[model samples]
Target: MSIQLYGLCETHSSEECNFYCRVCMFALCKECKKQHDIFEHEIIRAYKVNEVASFRLADLESLRDASDICPYKGNGRLVEVIYKRGDGIACCHGQGNVVECESCQYRLKSPSAKYCSIQCKVEAVMKMNESESVTNEAKRKVETISEESASDVKSFTKRPRE
Candidate 1:
């Protein structure tokens, strides 16, 4: 059973098919699978069931009312199937705390994220470095003036008062 023939997605030519849409009877990549999910269409792992008999059995199983539950401890929420990052499923419940990006103030999806995206993170770091450079330049100027004033004071103190 070689799925190499159906490896690439028809719609997304550049992406490889990871899921099979039973209703449409075609293979789908991770991005194209989202539409089928919204329509509540039956979807299965492309590698799991490529044969005609397996598709029929999967459809029969989908007709049941059984639902997938979260595997995390103490969280009994229903699981949402995620195809984008492999076959991993996630629970709907979040930690209740929201993280905002430091530069743009945009809401962050990842819990440990300091910025919303790579662009924002890069911009924030650049600005911080720029300010530090300006501050360093100003400190150098002040130190130079202080050293010149000290030299002048030493010359005045050494001269006898005529």
Candidate 2:
């Protein structure tokens, strides 16, 4: 299709423009395009959608790399990529930077942070403390029950008390 100059570029609002920012949906001219590029805005030549069609991935991927083009049928653009350092998969609906905690399997907000939340960290500590207490309780109950049984056996051995 042909690129139309609706009016002055959106960036400078004074200079003539031929290109448009796809992400922000703003128009930009040749001179403004250079300045907008520095900011890293995703821009594309505006084209009129004269026709729409239903297609499959096999058809689209064969024409061009699937990664370069959005798999969806209508968008006709590349998928936005968010950078991550770790091998762990992303969290927050595949948008934010998050990694699962090794201890609780919860997603941590920051890649560098260790735990997801204060509660998970607290649960870890409580488990340690609870383990010590639970073991001690079990030992005490065993000793008490054994003593009661031993007393009953001694009473049975004795003759009838007159």
Candidate 3:
């Protein structure tokens, strides 16, 4: 069978020499072999061309599978998980700096806990205060109502039969 090989340099003794290094598994040409001092006496061995090709094909297939099973493709699941655990949010650009907002749930793009705008920050703080106040007031009202109801029940039960 006839095979056309592109990019293969025509040189003598090409068949005798391995296509790649057995130690590093890097593809090498005939000139590279002499330059690197690779010989039968050399400690390092050379891998066959077919073996190197098979290894590369396997690596490509594994990479494709890994990309398919990756969880943080579009959802940024890894970042979200880290942020939810209070470890701070990582920059979208893969920087080590983690962005977080102390006053609100909004994540910043920098180390500073800044919102998109000053107004948004202020509104967030105000909303937080308002909600806290409402909760406290409700608790106070419930306690007062309970006390009044208890007093009324006591007085009604203590009334003599007249």
Q: Which stretches of candidate 3 lie over 4 Å from their true place?
A: 1-96, 100-117, 160-162
lDDT of candidate 2 over 36-152, digit per residue (tens): 764655565432222312123443343332232222223564221111122444345555455665445545444664443223333455687899999999999999999999999
| Model 3 agreement with the true structure over 1-162: per-residue lDDT tens digits | 011112253464343433344344344456655665645422222222322211222222323221211112122212111111122333344545645444333445545434432223345567888999999999999999999999999999999987
Cα TM-score per model: 0.37, 0.25, 0.31
The lDDT for every candidate, in the order shown, is 0.50, 0.48, 0.40
- Candidate 2, which segments miss by more than 4 Å at Cα? 1-99, 102-119, 158-162
Write the residue-wise lDDT of candidate 1 on 44-114 in tens digits.
65333222112222333454311221111112322222111112222333746865556555554556646
Best by lDDT: 1
Query: If candidate 1 were superposed on the true structure by all CA atoms, what would the RMSD be?
Result: 18.1
What local lDDT score does residue 126 receive in model 2, on the 0 to 100 scale? 69
Ten contiguous residues with the weakest lDDT in model 3:
76-85
